[model samples]
Target: MKYLIFGSKGQLAQEFINFFEKSSIQYKPLSKEELDVRDLDKVVNVVKEYKPDVIINCSAYNQVDRAQSFPEEAFSVNTLGVSNLGITCKEFKIFLVHYSTDYVFDGTKQDFYTEEDLPNPLNKYGESKLLGEFFIKNTLENYLIFRVSWVYGKGKQNFLYKLNQWAAANSMLKIAVDEFSVPTSTRTIVEITLKALKQGLTGLYHLTNSGYASRYEWSKEYLKLKQVDKLIYPAYQSDFNLPAKRPKWSVMSNQKISKILNTDIPLWNEELKLMVREMDI
Candidate 1:
């Protein structure tokens, strides 16, 4: 089956490209410079030209705090852009595979969030992503919307990369103790997505690692694995005083997808080790 991938330069998209190439899957990867998904006319033309059976959208506006100052930009890419793709995919009868985020929820739930859970986004970034999901669900029937969280991989855009940079720059670090979510690896996302596609699963599901962690906990584990000697002080989310308000407990449950795939996802720390080894860090 032929696949068309958007946002090829992202960590997640890069993982997808690597796996698809290794597996000899036919696909065309496009960067934001090559084609911005917000342009409906261009998006339609590209889909028509490629005629791909599946469109894997890795495009997203991920700047949480910046999104508050630039909601238009966030909505343009995360919402309107997704809407454009959904419209074109529906017109072409193509299956769409899009990625959402855990930020879609407001973290009001005491336990893990499921697919059935209603979304109540706290920030503009989250609002944009949630709206993108709505557009796809309202427009298309055959689509896989995976809401992932705390994603990290080969690129320099993730939390792990920032943590390493902080470790190198300073001997002490302050990480948020209240912010919580599963640290999902891009490798796991790509593998599970492929499996789900093969099984013809079409619905929204929370795709993440087996467990959850606060920013402080995650930072400690990562530092321990890398043998970094930095002293990390646990701090509350309010201490940072960011522009966008974040959910204190945004962990999502992957039981829905895991049961369907019949595969248990690796723990966050285990996946971190694998990623570190793979990156030769």
Candidate 2:
């Protein structure tokens, strides 16, 4: 099967490329500059030209706090771009895989959210992602939408990178204990997504790590792994006073994917350990 991946420069996209390269599948990875999704004409033309069996859209505007100030740009890239991709994929009868966020929910509920839960986004970024989800569901029948939370991995500006940077520069790190979610590793997401593609799975699925943790808890554990004894302070959301409203508890349950694939995903701590080993930090 021929797979065409968008946002080839992203960490998740890179992991997908690595997986595809090792597997028997053939793939064509394209960066944003290579195939600008914002251009509807270019997106349509590319799909028609490649005629790939699968289209994995890893491209997105993922700036949560910045989206508050630039909602239009976020909407243009996340919502409109996804709409164009969905239309093109539907026209070609290709399988579309889209990545969504746990921010789509308001995070009022204490329990872990399932795929059946209704989305009530509180911020602009979440709203834009939800719009993309709506477009894909309504426009394309063969689509797999994976809504993940607190994604961190070998990325340029992810949570882990920020934490490492802070730990390196400062003796003490102040992290939020109020906000909580399962920190998903990009490696796990790539593995599960590849398995789903091989099995031709469709519809919405919640893909996240096995456990949940707050920013403070995750930082504490990560710092310990890094052999740093810096005092990690736990603070509430009110202390930071960010422009965007974050979900208090947006941990997602991966039971649906596990039940379908008959496999178990590693816990967040275990995944983090692997990541730390890879980074040698």
Candidate 3:
């Protein structure tokens, strides 16, 4: 199948490229500078020219704290941009694959969140993403929406990269113990998404690692695995005092996608270790 990918520089998009190249799949990747998803005419024209069967959108407005101050910017990319892509895919009869976030939830539930859970976003970023998901669901039937959490991969826009930067700059760190979610690797997401597409699966599903962890736990494990010697302390989410109000617990259950794939996903820590090994750090 011919594939067209947006947000080519993103961590997830890069993973998709890596997989496609290795598998010798036909694909065309476009950076935001090349083709912004918000431009319907451009997107439609490109779709007409490429004639791709699948459009995997990795583009997003990921500035969580900044989104609180400038919601319009967030909505423009996450909501409006996605809506344009959805419309284009519908018009051309192409399958669309988009990624959402666990932030869609308000973190009130004590258990793992399922697909049936109602979303009540606490911040503008989450609201924007939730609205984006709505646009896709409302616009296209042949679409795959995967709600992932704490995603990290080759790109520097992830928690692992931020942790390394912080460790390099500071001798001590205080991570939030209250906030919790699964740290999903882009590799896992790309692999499973391809499998689902091959099987003709089309719907919304919570895609994440098998297990979950608090920021404190993930940080401790990441630092240990990277062999970084730093003084780390666990604190409440409020201690950092960020602009955006984050969910205290946004762990999503992967049972739905796991059962569909007929396989158990690797644990978050295991994936982290594998990522670090690949990093050769």
Candidate 4:
């Protein structure tokens, strides 16, 4: 099957590329510069030209704080861009695989969120992504939307990278203790996506490492693995003074996915160890 992947330069995109390289899969990767998703005409043209069996859209406006100031750009890229892709894919009968985030839900519920829960986004970024989700679900029949959270891996930009940098340069690092969610690894996400493709699964699913952790807790684990635990300190969200309001509880339950796939997700600590070992941390 010919697979076309957008957002080729991102960490998840790179991981997907690596997975494709090792397998016998035929795939094409495109960066934002190569194909601007915001332009409907260009997006339609690219879809027609590639004629891929599966189209994985990894491109998104991920700047959470900056999105507050540039809501229109965020909505255009995350919502309108996705709408264009979905319409084109629908016309050609291509399987559309899109990634979403747990931020789509407000942190009002104390327990883990299920697929049936209604989305109430708290920030512009979340609102934009939720809008994209609606467009895809309404426009396309052959599609799978995977909602993930707290994604990190050997990426150019991620929480892990920032933690590493802070640990090396500063004597101490303060992280938010109240903000909580399941931290997902890029490798796990790619593997799950590939598995879903193999199984011909099509629907919405929540994908993340088995357990949840606060930003402070997750950072502490990373620091411990790096032998820099002493340098880290926990602080409340109000102390950070961020521009955008984040969900206090973004944990997602993967019971549905596990039942469908007959497999369990790895624990956050186990995946963290694997990541650290793979990166030789």
Candidate 5:
């Protein structure tokens, strides 16, 4: 199958590239410089030229706080750009595999969120991603959308990477205790995506680790695994006072995907411990 990846330089994009490289899959990776999604004409042209069986969109505007100040930029990439891709994919009869986020939910649910749950994003970034989902769902019939949570691995900006670096240098750390979600590995995400495709499972599904953890709890696990001697303290989200309002609860249920794939997902701490041991961090 011919696979084409957009946003070739993103964190998750890099992971996809690595996976494809090690596999027998043939794919064309396009950076923003190579192909801007907002340029509808160019996007349509690229789709026609590539004639790919699947177009995996790794492109996203992820700056949560900055998105509030630059909603246009976020929407251009997250919503409008996705709309263009969906339009072109629909025209070309290509299966579009897109990634969404758990942030689409407002965290009002006391338990985990399912695919049937209504999305009410609290921040501009979340709103943009949620709209992107709508664009694809409305524009195309052949599409698979996976809503992932707290992705980490082979990325400098992720929580584990930052906390590992900080705990190594600093003696103390202050982490938010309120924010909670399952931390997922990029490798696991890629594997699940491929497996789901093989199983002919297509549609919107919530994908994450089997369990959940708060920022503080997740950080302590990482530090403990790394054997860092940092004195970690608990802090609330209000302590930081960021520009974007966050959902107090961000855990998502992965039962839908798991049931279709008939695969069991590891707990957040289980995955974290494995990653910590596997990597030199």
Candidate 6:
């Protein structure tokens, strides 16, 4: 299928490029400079020119804390930007693949969150992201919305990369003991996307590692695997005193995506080790 990827430099975008690097599929990859989703005319013009069958949007306003101060910037990309794409894709009869976060749902549920759960965003970023999803769901007939959490991989800033860097620099570190979610790899997201595309799967799904971990546990495990010795301590989320409020438990159920893959996802630690091996961390 002919494909177009928005946000070429983003982590998921790079993973998609890596996955299709040697494949025969025709694709046009564009960065923010090449295509700004906020500009409706530019978005429409690009889609009209490419006439792609599938358009994967990896662009988003992902700075959670900063979003509290810049809701307009967040909405411009996450809400209005997506609205532009959704409308254009609908007009062109193109299948849209949008990535979302588990933050849409307040982390109040005791069980793993499914697609059925109603979204109640606790922060401005989550509210903006949820608006994007609503626009796509209302605008397009063929679309795939994957809600993932704690995604990490090469060629971009992510959880694991930040943790490793901090661990290496500090003799001691404090992490949240309450907040939890699957530390999904960008590779995992890319693989599942390819499979879903091949199967023609359309709808909402949660794509993440099989297991979940709190920031403290994930950091300890990552340090152990990397054999990096550091004095890491568990602390409350409030101890950080960040600008935005984060959910205490944002873990999502992967059963929906797992069903399509015909197998369970790899353990977060397993995938973590694999990613570190690739980076020689």
lDDT of each: 0.94, 0.90, 0.94, 0.89, 0.88, 0.90
Question: What value does the lDDT take at residue 273 in candidate 6?
Answer: 89
lDDT tens per residue, model 5, 3-118: 99999987788888998888968999999999999999998888888889999999888888999988999999999999999999988899999999998989889999999999
Better of 3 and 4 by lDDT: 3
RMSD of each: 0.8, 1.2, 0.8, 1.1, 1.3, 1.2
Worst 10 residues of 5 by lDDT: 272-281
Candidate 6 regions exceeding 4 Å error are: 279-281
lDDT of 2 by residue, 207-279 (tens): 9989899999998888889888899888898899898999999989999999999999999999889888885
Candidate 2 deviant stretches above 4 angstroms: 279-281
Q: Which stretches of candidate 4 lie over 4 Å from their true place?
A: none
- lDDT per residue (tens digit) for residues 1-281 in model 4: 99999999988898899888999689999999999788888878887888899999999899999998889988998999999899989888999999999999999998999999999999999999999999999998889999999888767668888778877788878889999999889989998888888899998999888989999989988888877746567789889888879999999998888888888889988998998988653
Q: What is the lDDT of residue 52 in candidate 1?
A: 98
User: lDDT of model 3 at residue 161?
Assistant: 88
TM-score of 1: 0.98
Can you give the lDDT of residue 277 in candidate 6? 88
Candidates in order, TM-scores: namely 0.98, 0.97, 0.99, 0.97, 0.96, 0.97
Pairwise TM-score winner, candidates 5 and 6: 6
lDDT of 6 by residue, 189-244 (tens): 99888889889999899999988999999999988988889988889999999998
> lDDT of candidate 2?
0.90
